[model samples]
Structures are given as C-alpha cells and as structure tokens.
Target: MTNEEFLSKMQDVLQTEEELKLDTVLDDLAEWDSLSVMATMAFLDKDFGVKTTMKDYKNVKTIGDIAQKAGL
Candidate 1:
C-alpha cells in the first residue's frame, strides 16, 4: 500500500484524531499506548504479513519506523 494510505489507516489503529506524519514520534501521541502497539502488531501481520514482538518496538520511534515494517 502507499505511504499515504498507511498513514491514514494508522489513525484507525491508534484510535486517535491526531494527524500522523513520517517524522511524528510515537511517544508524543497520547494514543500510542500498549493497546496501540498491540493493534499495530496485528495490523502489520494482517495487512503486510510482517511479524513484530513487543521487543521490536524498542527500535520503533516514529511512524516511519512502522511504515518500514510494513515495507511502505
């Protein structure tokens, strides 16, 4: 999927109204909690066939990081 689509869909995964950008830091979002992380894990697996553990999130700092995981 395109980067734009992925970013837009991430709002759903995050359940937030905030506009996300490639450089937007996940930690800066109030919605970027444990649930969001878990949802993101599911989203990646369901949509991109990518697998990620909680441990993987230590390296994920921004929206772009998740996009990379999705191969966007």
Candidate 2:
C-alpha cells in the first residue's frame, strides 16, 4: 500500500479526518489509547494481513512507522 492509502486507512480507523501529518506522534492523538492500539492492530491484520502486538507498537513512534509496516 501507498503512504496515502495508509493514512486514509488510519483516518478511518481513528474515525477522524483530522489530517495526520507523517511526523505526528501517536500519543498526541486523543483517540490513541489502548483501545486505539488494539484497533490499529486489527486494522493492520485485516487490511494488510500484518499481525502486530503492543511490543511491536513500542518501536513505532510516528505515523511513518505504520506506513513502513504496511510496506508503503
């Protein structure tokens, strides 16, 4: 998937159109709590077929990390 596609998917998962800049910190998002993490994990698995755990998320500090994982 492309970075744009990844961002779109993230927006959908996060349920916001609040333009996610690539450098935006995940923690900066109000919706980015544990539930959001689980949602993201599910999104990755369902959409990209990439299984991930909280441990995997520990290394992901930015939206770019998600894009990279999605092979953008």
Model 2, stretches more than 4 Å misplaced?
A: none
CA lDDT, candidate 1, residue 13: 94
lDDT scores for all predictions? 0.95, 0.82
- Superposed by TM-score, candidate 1 places the C-alpha of residue 68 at a distance from the truth, in angstroms, of 0.4
lDDT by residue (tens digit), candidate 1, 1-72: 888899999999999999999999999999999999999999999999999999999889999999998888
Q: Enumerate residue pairs that collide in model 2.
A: none
Model 2 is weakest, by summed lDDT over 10 consecutive residues, at: 14-23
Tens digits of per-residue lDDT, candidate 2, 2-52, equal 677778889888876578867888878877778878888999889889899
Q: Candidate 1: deviation at residue 55, Å?
A: 0.4
* Candidate 1 colliding pairs, count: 0
Candidate with maximal lDDT: 1
